[model samples]
Every structure is written in structure tokens, then in C-alpha cells.
Target: MTAHTATTLRSAGSTGISLPEAIRRADLGDAVALLASAKKYTVARLSGGRLSVPGKGSFADGAGVAGTSTERALPLSTSGPDAVFEARIFNKDAELRWLHEGDGLGTAVVLSESPDICRPLGEFLDPLYAVEQIDNRYLLWGRPLRSHDSGASTGPLSTGPLSTGPLWVRLAEARIGLLDVPVSRAPRENECVFLRTVEYVTTEPEHGNAYVAEERLVELFLAPPEQSKAAGSPQPDRLPEATR
Candidate 1:
């Protein structure tokens, strides 16, 4: 996408919001950021469910089940042929096991050093916002794209099998490194990754509705959960941030 086109999409409908900007502000230095409290990552998706305060338009729950989550990360790098690392972060509900229902959601985007990498995802950031279904991850945008990869317009990214495993990219660690550690397998929407720490976060909705705009109440403690025996402070300094 050209600079002109990039600017075009941001101005499309919703103010100047674009995926890159959202990722920029995600606080984690990734596409997503959770407000920190105590020793836990406050993982919140833009809730499809909204908390309607009488006259309020409908504010979606920004935070999900807090201390009950585990994070697996891999940094984004490698510029030459593969700048775009594509994959799906899939999870199902604790009780409801339906795919494409969007029970799973999250993205912590660490900005890459390459403009090439950011540009591709930029093309569809607007559509991502306009999408009616709040939880749907981008299978491909409805738009035809002329990608930098082939100079040919391709459809949305091939829907890789809902990652039964965790997330992406590569290079020798000489100057490259994986984000955190690639997750071995995806935790079911509400399963615990560690047997000892049963406080894994659930992507499942606090309430059931086919789409977002309904508010789901995720429980979060001012402190870590009683079940967590693991120890560490989720201090802001401990989390990664964009190079900028």
C-alpha cells in the first residue's frame, strides 16, 4: 500500500483509527495492550458486549478475565521475503465450543522495523473496524489488494487452520529473536496453560450474544487470583514497548 492509500483508509469512516495505530497504542508494544494492575496482564479485547449506562450509546467491556490468562509471544522481524507473519489466535468459550463465533480474540502487535511488514496489514485496517461481527479475525478483507510481495492483488490471507498451536516469524537470533516463546498449543478459550496455576484467562464472553454490543462481565481481582502460586510483578517496566 502506498502512503497515499494508507492515509486514505484511516480517513475512511472511523476517525483516524487504523490497525497500526491501534497496535501502536496497545501499550504492550504489540497490537494489543492491557492496562497493568498488580502482577497480572489485564488482557482486554474491544468487547462486542457493551455496558449500557442508561443514556450511554453502549460502551464495550474493555477488560476480559484478567489474572486468569497466560501469554505466549513471538516478536515480528525478518524483512526480505517474509515481513508479514500471519496466523490466527483462536479460542472457544468455556461452555460453548463453536468456531467462527469469535469466542477467541486478542492481538499484541510488536511493531516491526520494516515498513513493508506494516503496510500489508494496513490495507485492511479500515475494514477491520467496519466489520459487523466484532470478534471475527481477518480471514481476508473483502477488498482486492495489490500486495508488495507479488505486485499482484491477492485475496485476504489464506485462513490458516485456527492455530491449534500458538503464534509466528523467523531468522537466526544473531540480530533476531522470537517475541516471547511460541505457544506450544492454544489454550481452549478458558483452559489453564499451567496445571499449577489454574488462573488462565478466558476469551469466552461473560454473557452470550451472537455479536458484540452486548456487554460481558469479566472478573478481575485487584490482586492476583488466589489460585496463582507463580510469582512475579507485572510491573510496567517488565512489559515490552515499541522501539519508538
Candidate 2:
């Protein structure tokens, strides 16, 4: 995954139309085309209950009951009802469930940030997209490498470095010292640290909102490596420009 290689893959068979741009113009054909051009991610074509992977075996759906149907989604995994894909995001692992409809046209992309839900039993999708049988949609799934640790709670319950305000080497969509607390991590030129929020505020304050002092440090998500490289190091005052 060198810089040159990544650039070459992105330029390969490119139509000069990005996914967001195609969606903005309401161009389904261009969007599908752009998605198909992506070389790094898995892209499959579905037709007549058969899924055709470019360099893999074609899978046929199994027997089904009345309302629910089983899909033989071997591209993600084999001999299981679950389909998971793992991708590196923000230098850490982010997992999402790859669920498909009876026809395998519609997919439910669920983020795996919770542990209570079994990895096999997935949840609903966030920012779901629709694609025809001929179109290709990006899939994401699987539990994080540290699945033994629970990701469901946002509170800093563990008395490890997490509660002691670990130093942050990077950040995204946030600024240093935004929280009303003492900043002890003496961030470098572009680095920051986690801070525990002493109070919490809720929206709809005009109506009725709870005011409590919740001792917890909100989650911090880092930017993707590609985006970080593109934007360069972030300044203390501003975050890096978002990439499409």
C-alpha cells in the first residue's frame, strides 16, 4: 500500500466521477460505475440468486423459510450465517456487518462497536445505500481485534490508561482543549489528549433537559491514514480539510 500503488489503483479505469458527486447529481449509473471502478474493496455482482465474485466462486442461496431467506454469501465467509468485513480506519480497526436481502440486492451495513450483540446476529444499518442486482456496493463487517474488550459503553469505566487521560497522537473533527477541563497531556504541535468531561448538556434545553456531571471522556476517532496524509498534519486551531 505504497503511495504510488494507491494512486495507481485509484486512477485505474477511472471515470473521473466520484461517488459523492454521482450521488449529488442523482446519477445511479455513474455511482455504480464509480463503485465498480474501486480496486481495493470487494465488489460483487448478483443475478438470479447467484453471487459472482470477480476472482472467486459463485455462491447460490440455500433453502429458506416463508418470510426469511438464507443467502450463501461465501465471498465474506464460508459455512456461517454471518458475513463480516474488517477495514483499518484511523490507525485502529473498525468493523461492520455485511447483511444482504433475500435477493441479495439490498445490504445492511452495521458498525460493530458493541459487544452485547453476537457477531453472528447483526443489527440495523447506518447510512444504508441501495443498489440494483447489477450494481456493486461496498461492504464492511466483523468485530474489532480486541473483541474481549466491550465497545458498547462510552463511559470510561475501566481504570486503565483510558481513565487516566491518554495522550492523543491524532484527532479529527475536534479541537484541543475544547472540553472545560485541565489539559495535562501537553500536546505537541499537532497532538492532543483525552479529557474527562465533568458536566454533560443535552439539546432541546428550552423544553426539558437533564443537567448532570457525568465523569467520562467522550470517544475520540482518528482520521483515516489516506485522509491524514492528504491533509497533512492538523494545526492546533483547526482540523484537517475533509476529503471525499
Candidate 3:
């Protein structure tokens, strides 16, 4: 029912809970499930450079991230199709600011405070957005970076690609960073949560998994089409581009 559900394997209280305790209990599976299922969450789009955790006063970028597990936390994530939703959650990254009881680190942002996305956004994204629910990963159809007119995106996120193709995110990675900002349903995309970055991320159509956009990341429409039948539904493994 809540984002914390991913952080903790056990069901989180529908209302009022301790952020640290929830995170402490959350495992990778719980986090992935939360990201795949939560209606919204705040996801951090890597500003630039490789993903790294910042200490209270400085940024740390070492390959071995295991040491920061107990103290690392990032305070941002973009949600909603096309990444229109953004929210601030407890500052659990690097600073461990949440450890301070009265700092208001884990305080949840009010849904009303989020911006409104035009119905067109939902309509535009609905055909391409969806949640995998079980795979613990976000998938999207891929388009080249040049396909768009704007070339200002110089960040590493312009398009999602591995050594050969587009990029993919672990469900837990996306969910933990995202805070679903609220918007009333206009187009169906408004009804779901997505993984986004600061810049656009690209994935190939045949890739099955979707890409994450930067500024407003895209959650690939992996779910079955609202208009389609489920009898022969395409699973992620057989992704015929999951949704329309």
C-alpha cells in the first residue's frame, strides 16, 4: 500500500511509520517489489558521472559500495509516466540525516504539492508506459537520442544502453529513489508510477525491458494494454514490447 512496503518485507502500516526501521528491514526483493508496484515514488536521476553516494559533506565514488549500505541514501526520485511526478522523501542517502530524530528527514511530501500533468501526457505515455510488477525491473520501448529535436542533454542518461544497447534498472533501485508525486487521473499514465532520471533514457523495442528518462523518466508500458485481452498476454521474458 505504501513505498515502505518495498523497503520492508512485511506489510508496512498504511499510515505513520518509522522510516529507518522500515528501510532496515527492507531487502532487495522488497525494494524491487515496492518499485514495481507502488503507485509513485521519488527516483533520483544521476546528475552526471557514474552513480555514487555522497557523504554528508562530500561525494564518494568507489566501485565497492558495500561499505555505504548502512549509511547511504539518496533523497530524490521521479515517478509517473514520462516522469512528471517528483517528490522529496526522508534524506536517507549518504548523510544518514534520518538518524537525527527531529530533522524531518523521512517526512512525506504532500501529494497536493506535486505539479499537474496535462491529460495529453498520460495519453502520450500510456501507450508506452507500464509496470512489470514481478520482474523487479522497469522496461520501455527505445528511441534514439537524436530522434528528439533537443540535444541539450549531455548527461549520461540521454539513452539507456549497456555495452551494446539500452539500459535497465533493478526494481528496488528505481523504487527506493522515487517518491510518487500525485496527480489526478486524466490519461491512464496518471494512475501508475514510473522510474525516471534527469535526462531521457533509451531502450530498443526488441530489448523487452524499458528505459528510464532523466528529467521525467519513462516507465516502459510493460503491463497489458487496457484494451487488450489477457489470455495470451506477453510476459516480460517474451516481451513483444509488453504494451502498446
The lDDT leader among the candidates is 3
Cα-based lDDT for every prediction: 0.21, 0.21, 0.22
- Candidate 3 per-residue C-alpha lDDT over 1-244 given as tens digits, one digit per residue, 9 for 90 to 100: 0111111011111113233332332211111111211243232222221122323322122111112222234442333342212122211111101111222233211111012311211111112122211222222222112111123321112322222111222121232331212111111111122222122233456966645321222232222233222323333333222111
Task: Give the clash count for each candidate.
Answer: 21, 3, 45
Give the runs in model 1 whose Cα sits over 4 Å from its true position.
Answer: 1-32, 37-41, 45-110, 119-244
Model 2 residue runs over 4 Å out of place are: 1-91, 95-118, 123-186, 190-244
The lDDT-based order of candidates, best leading, equals 3, 2, 1
Residue 69 of model 3 has an lDDT of 28
Q: Count clashing residue pairs in model 1.
A: 21
Query: Could you estimate the TM-score for every candidate?
Result: 0.17, 0.17, 0.22
By TM-score, the better pick of 1 and 3 is 3
Give the TM-score ranking, best first: 3, 2, 1
lDDT by residue for model 1 over 115-173, one digit each (tens)?
33334322323211111211111010011111123222232222222333222101012
Per-residue lDDT tens digits for candidate 2, residues 1-244, read 1111100000001123222221222211110010111132332222232332322111112100011022233243321333322211110112222222232222322122233321232333332121111111111111111111324222221222221222112122222211211112322222223211112222344865433311111223222234333444333334211111
The TM-score of candidate 2 is 0.17
